[model samples]
Target chain A: MHRFANPARFLRIAKPLTPALFWLGLLLTLIACIWGLFFTPTERLMGDTVKILFVHVPSAWLGMGGWTGIAIASIVQLVWRHPLAGVAARAIAVPGATFAAICLITGSIWGRPTWGTWWVWDGRLTSMLVLFFLYLGYIALSNASSEKGDTSRVAAVFGVIGAVNIPIINRSVVWWESQHQKASITLGGSSIDTAYLVPLFIAVVGFSLLFGALVLMRMRTALAEMRIEARMRRMAQG
Target chain B: MPHAPFIIASFAVTGVFMTWLIVSSYLSMRRAEASADALREQS
Candidate 1:
C-alpha cells in the first residue's frame, strides 16, 4: 500500500484505472438515472417529488464520505507525513466540496415541496452547510500558503477540526426535534420499503462511483500541476 | 403528485447544477493538462 505512496507509481497505476473507472461510473450513473427516473414507482405521499431522493441521498452520502477521506488523509499527512498524503488531501477537497454543495442544493430542492421552504435553519442542514464551507476553507488555505509543507499542515489541522462536525451532522436528527427525516437504512430497521430500496441502492452505488472517478481525475490534475511547478522552480534556481 | 410545477422546478434546477459541475471540472482539468504540456515543452 505504502509502495504506491510515490506519486509516479500511483500515477502509473491510476492511468490505466482511470479509463476503466470512467466507463464504469458512466454506465452505472446512466443505469441509475434511467431506473430512478422511469422505473421506480412514485410515492403515494410525496408522489413524483420523492424521486429527488435518488440523487439527493447519494450525494449526501458522498458528501460525508469525501470529508471522511479528507480527515484520514489529513491525519496521515500530519502524523505519518506520508509522501503523497497532502496531495491526496488537496485532491479530495475539490470533489468533496462539489458533493457537499450538491447535497445542500438538492436537499433544499427536496425540502421546498416537502418542508414548505427552500431554506431551513435545522441543525442537520446547518451542519451540512458548515461542512461545505469547511471544504472551501481547506482549498483556500492550501492555495494561499506559500510553502507546500506549511500548506499541508494548515489544511490538515482544519481537516481534523472540521471533522468534529461530521458526527454532529449525522446525529442532528436525533439530537434536535427537527423536520428532517431519520435514517432510511438503520441497523435493525429500514424506513424505506423494498420497492423503493432497490433503485435507491443503485443510485447510491452509481453516485459513489461517479465521486470516485471525479476525485481520481482531480488528483491526477493536481499531480500534474505540482510536477510542472517543481520543474519550473528547479529551472529558475539552477 | 399534486405539484407538477414544483417537481419540474426541482429536477430542472438540480439537473442544471449537476451539468455545470461536470462541464466545469472537465474544462479545469483540461486546462491544467494543457498548461502542464506547455511547461514540459518549455523545459
Candidate 2:
C-alpha cells in the first residue's frame, strides 16, 4: 500500500491497468446482460421483473462496496498518512454515489411492479437511502478539501463514520419487516437457482471491475491535478 | 415480458449513469493530463 504512495509509481501501473479493466469489464457485462436478459427463464413469481436483478444487485453491492473502499482508504489516510489515501477516497465518492443512486432508482423501478409501489420506508430501504446521502456529503466535503494535496482529515473522519451505515444496510432486511427480500446468497448456501445465479455472479464481477477501473481513472486525474497545482506553486515561489 | 418497461428502464438508467461517470471522469483526466504536460514543458 505504501509503495503506491508515490504518484509516479501509481500512475505507471494504473496507466496500463485502467483500460484493461474497463474493456474487459465492459465485455463481461455485455455478455452477462445478454445471457440474463434473453437466454434465461423468468422467475415463477416475479416473472420478467426479476430481470432487473442483473443491474440492481450489482449496483447494490458496489454502492456498499464503494463506501467500504472509501472507509478503508480513509483509515489508511488517517493512520499511515499514505499520500494516495485521500486521493483514492475522493476518487471513490462520485462513482460510489452514482452506484448508490443507481441502486435506489433501479430498486424503486423493480419495486413498482413487484411490490406495487416505487418505494417504502422500511429499514433496508431507509438505511440504503442514508448511505446514498452519506456518499453525497462525502463527495462535497472531499471536493472542498482537495487543495490540501494529501490530507482531508474531516472527510476521512466522515468516511469512517459513514461506514456505520453499511452494517445497518446489510442487516436491515433481516432485522426488520420489509418488502425487500432477505439474502438469497448467504455463506450457508444460495437460494437462487443455478441458471440465474451464474450470470448474476458474472455481472457482479464485471461491474466490480468497472468500478475499479473508474476509481483508477479518477485517482490518476486527481494525481494529475495535484501535479499541476504543485507546478504552479513552485513557479510562483521561484 | 409483462414488466418490460421496468426492466428496460432499470438497465437504461444504469447504462446512462455508467456512461456519464466514465465519460466525465475520462474527460477530466484528459484535461488535467494536458494541463500538467503543458506546465512540464513550460518548466
Candidate 3:
C-alpha cells in the first residue's frame, strides 16, 4: 500500500488500469446479466421476479461494501495520515450512495412483484435505507469540509462512526422477523441453485470491478485537483 | 416474463445509474487532469 503512496507511481498504474477494469467489467456485466436474465431457469417460487436478483444482489453488496471501504480509508487517514486516504474516501462516497440507491430501488421493484407491495418497514430494508441516507450525509459533509480546505478530519470521523450501521444492516434480517429472506449464501453452503448462483457470482464480480475503477478515476481527479490548488497557491505567493 | 415491467424497470434503472456514474467519473478525471496540465505549464 505504501508503494502507491507516491502520486506519480499511482497515476502510472491507475491510468492503464482504469480502462482495463472498465471494459472488463462491462463485458462481465453484459455476460452475467444476459445469462441471468435469459439463460437461467425461472425460479420455482418467485417466477420471473427472480430475474431482478442479478442486479439487486450486486447492488446491495456494493452498497455495503463501499461503506466498508470508506471506513477503512477513514482509519488510514486518521492513523497513518496517508495523504490519499481522504481523497479515496471522498471518491468512494458518490458511487457508494448511487449503489445504495440502486439496491433500494431494485429491491423495491423485486418486492412489489413477490411481496405484493412497493415498500416495507422491515429490518433489512430499513437498515439499508439508513445506509443510503448515511452516504448522502457523508457526501454532503465531506464536500462541505473539502471546500473549506481543512476539515477532512471531521469527515474521517464521520466515516469511522457511520460504520456502526454496517453490521446492523448485515444482521438486521436475523435479528428481526422481516419478510426479507435470511441469508441464502453462507459459510456452510449456498441455498441458491447452481444455475442462479453462477451468474449471480459473475454479476457481483462485474459490479465490484466497476466500482473499483470508478474509485480510481475519482481518486485521480482529486489528486489532480490537489495539484492545481498547490500550483495556484505557489503562483499567488510569487 | 410474467411481470415483465418490473424486471425491465429493475434492469433499466441499474443501467442508467451505472452508466451515469461511470461516465461522469471519467469526464471529471479528464477535466481535472487537463486543468492540472494547464496550470503546470503556467507555473
Candidate 4:
C-alpha cells in the first residue's frame, strides 16, 4: 500500500489500468441504465418513480464512498506522510461534492413526485444535505489556506470530521422520522426484489469504477502540477 | 408511469451533465499534464 505512495510508482500503476476502468465503467453504466429503464418492473406504489433509484441511490453511495476515500487519504497524508495522499485527497474533493449535490437534487426531484413535496426536513434528507454542504466547506477551507501544509492539514481535519456523518446519514432513516425511505438494498441484506436489485448493483459498480478512474486521473494531474510548481520555485531562487 | 416523462427528463439531464463533467475534467487534466511536461522540458 505504502509502496505506491510514491507518485511516480502510483502513476505507472494507474496509467495502464485507467483505460480499462473507463471502458468497463462506461459499459456497465449503460447496461444498468438500459436494464432499469426497459427491463425492471414499474412499482406498484410509485410506478415509474421507482426507476429513479437506478440513478439516485448509486450516486448517493458514490458520493459517500468518494468522501470516505478522501478522508482515508487525508489520514494517510497526515499520519504516514504519504506523498501522493494529499494529491488523492485533493483530487476527490470536487467529484465527491458533485455527486453529493446530485444525490440531494435527485432526491428532491423524486420527492416531489413520491411525497408530493420538493423539500423536507426529514432526518435522512437533512443529513444528506448537510453532507453536501460539508463537502463544499472542506473544498473552500482547503483553498483558503495559502501555505500548502496549512491547506492539507485544514482539509484533513475537515475530511475526518465530515466522515463521522456518513454513518449518521446511513442510519438516519432507521433512527429518526424520515420522509426518505429506508434503503431497499443494504450491505447485510437487501429488501428490494431481484428485478430492481440487480440493476441497482450494476449501477453501483459502474459508478464506483468511474469514480476511481476520475480520482486517478485527477491525482496524476495534481502530482504533475505540484512538480512543475516546485521546479519553477527552484529556478526563481537560482 | 404517471410521470414517466419527468423522471426520464431528470435522468437524461443528470446523465448528460455527468458525462460532460467527466469529459471536461479529463480534458483539463490532460491539458495540465501537457503543460507540466512542457515546463519540465524548459527546465
Candidate 5:
C-alpha cells in the first residue's frame, strides 16, 4: 500500500490498466445493453419500461459505491496519511456525482408510468437525492480546501461523515413502508427471475468496470497536478 | 405497453453522461501531463 503511494510507481501500473478496463467495460456494457433491450422478455406487469432497470440500477449502485470509495480513501488519508489517498477521493467525486444524478433522473422517468407520479418523497428516492447533494458538497469542500492551501483533512473528514448516508440509502425502502419496492436482490438471495437477472448482472459488471476506469483516469490527472505543484514550490524555494 | 420512449431516454441520458465524463477526463489528463512535462523540462 505504502509503496504504491509513489506517483510514478502508481502511474506505471495505471497507464497499462486504464485502456484495458475502459475497452473491456465498453464492450461488456454494449453487449449487455443490446441483450437487455432485445432478447430479454418484458415484464408482464411493467412491460418494456422494465428495460430501464439495466441502466438505472447500475447507476444507483455505482452512485453509492463511489462514495464508499471516497470513505475508504478518506480513511487511508486520515489514518495512514497516504499521499495519494486524497487524490483518489477527489478523483472519484465527479463521476460519482454524475452517476447519482443519472439514477435520480432515470428513477423519476421510470416512476411516472409505473407510479403515476413523476416525483415522490419516498425514503429510497429522497435518501438518494440526499446522497447526490452530499457528493456536491464534498466536491465544493475539496476545491475550497485545495485553493486555500489547507490540508485535505477537512474534505477527508466530510467524506467519512457523509458515508453515513450510504446505508440509509440502501435500507431506506426496508426501514420504511414506501411506494418504492424493497430490495429485489439481497445478500441472502435475489427475487429477480433468471431471465432478467442475467443481463442485469452483466450490466452491473460493465458499469462497475467503466466506473473503475474513470476513477483511475482522474487519479492519474490528480497525481500529475500534484507533481507539478511540488515542482513549482521547489523552484520557488531555490 | 408502449413505454419505449422512457426506456430510450434513460439509456440515452446514461450514455451521454458517461461519454462526457470519459472524454473530459481524458482531455484533462492530457493537459495535466503536458504541463507537467513542460515543468520538468524547465527544471
Candidate 6:
C-alpha cells in the first residue's frame, strides 16, 4: 500500500489497467443488460418490472460501495497520510453520487406501478436518500478544501464520519417494516430464483468493474492536476 | 410486458448517466494530461 503511494509508481500500473478494466466492464455490462432485458423470465408478480432489478440492485450496491471506498480511503489519508488516498476518495465522489441518484430514480420508477406511488418514506428509501445527500456533501466539501489549498483532512474526516449512514441504509429494510422488499440476496441464502440471480450477478460485477475504472481515471486526472499545481508553484517561486 | 416502459426507462437512465460519466472522466483526464504536457514543455 505504502509502496504504491508514490504517484508515478501508481501510474505505471494504472495506465495499462484503466483501459482494460473499462473495456471489459463495458463488454460485460452490455451482455448482462441484454440478457436481463430480453432473455430472463419476468416475475409472476411484478411482470417485466422485475427486469429493473438488474440495474437497480447494482446501482444500490455500488452506491453504498462507493461510500465504503471513500471511508476506507479517508482512513488511509488520515492515518497513513497516503497521498493517493485523498485522490482516491475525491475520485469516487461523482460516480458514487451518480450511482446513488440512479438507484433512487430507478427504484422510484419500479415502485410507481408496484406500490401505486412514485415516492415512499420507507426506511430503505429514506436512508438511501440520506446516503445520496452524504455523497453530495462530501463532493462539495472536498472541492471547497481543494480550491482553498487546504489539506483534505477535513473532507477525509467527513468521509469517515459519513460512513455511519451506510449501515443504517443497509439494515433499514430489515429494521423497519417498509414498502421496500427485504434483502432477497444475503449471506444466509438468496431468495431470488437462479434465472434472475445470474444476470443480476453479472450486472453487479460489470458495474463494479466500471466503477473501479472510473475511479482510476479520475484519480489519474487528479494526480495530473496536482503535478501541474506543484509546477506552477515552483515557477512562481523562481 | 405491461411494465415495459418502466424497465426501459430505468435502463435508459442508467445507460445515459453511465455513458456521460465515463466520457466526462476520460475527457477530463485527456485535458489534464494535455495541460500537464504543456507545462512540462514550458519548464
Tens-place lDDT digits, model 4, residues A69-168? 8889989988998888887888899889888877887888888888999899989988888888888998898778656787888898889888999999
Reference contacts preserved by each model: 0.39, 0.94, 0.91, 0.55, 0.78, 0.83
**Which parts of model 1 have CA positions greater than 4 angstroms off?**
B37-42
Q: What tens-digit string does per-residue lDDT give for candidate 2 at A26-45?
A: 99899999999998898999
TM-score of each candidate structure, all chains considered together: 0.91, 0.97, 0.97, 0.95, 0.97, 0.97
User: What range of 10 consecutive residues in model 5 chain A has the weakest lDDT sum?
Assistant: A144-153
lDDT of 3 at A84: 78
The window of 10 residues in a row where model 1 chain A has the poorest summed lDDT is A17-26
lDDT of 6 by residue, A1-238 (tens): 8999999999999999999999999888999999999999968999889999999999999999999999999999989989899899999999999999999999999999898999989899999999999998898898885562364788899999999999999899889999998889888999999999999999999999999999999999998998899999999999
Measured over the true interface residues after superposition, the C-alpha RMSD of each candidate is 2.3, 1.4, 1.5, 1.9, 1.2, 1.4
lDDT of each: 0.80, 0.92, 0.93, 0.84, 0.93, 0.93
Question: Mind giving the per-residue lDDT tens digits that candidate 5 earns over A1-238?
Answer: 9999988898999999999999999998999999999999979888889999999999999999999999999999999989889899999999999999999999999998899898999999999999999999999999985562364789999999999999999889989999899999999999998998999999999999999999999998988888899899999999
User: Between prediction 1 and prediction 6, which has the larger TM-score?
Assistant: 6
Candidate 4: regions farther than 4 A off: none
> What is the TM-score of model 3 when looking only at chain B?
0.87
Candidate 5 deviant stretches above 4 angstroms: A147-151
Which pairs of residues collide in model 3?
none
C-alpha RMSD of each candidate structure in angstroms: 2.0, 1.3, 1.2, 1.4, 1.3, 1.2
**What is the lDDT for A183 in model 4?**
74
Angstrom error of the Cα, residue A83, model 3: value is 0.5
* Clash list (residue pairs), candidate 5: none
Judge candidate 5 against the unseen true structure and give its global Cα lDDT, from 0 to 1.
0.93
Candidate 5 positional error at A119, Å: 0.8
TM-scores for chain B, listed for all candidates = 0.85, 0.92, 0.87, 0.78, 0.86, 0.88
- Model 3 lDDT per residue over B1-43, tens place: 3688999999999999999999999999999999999988877
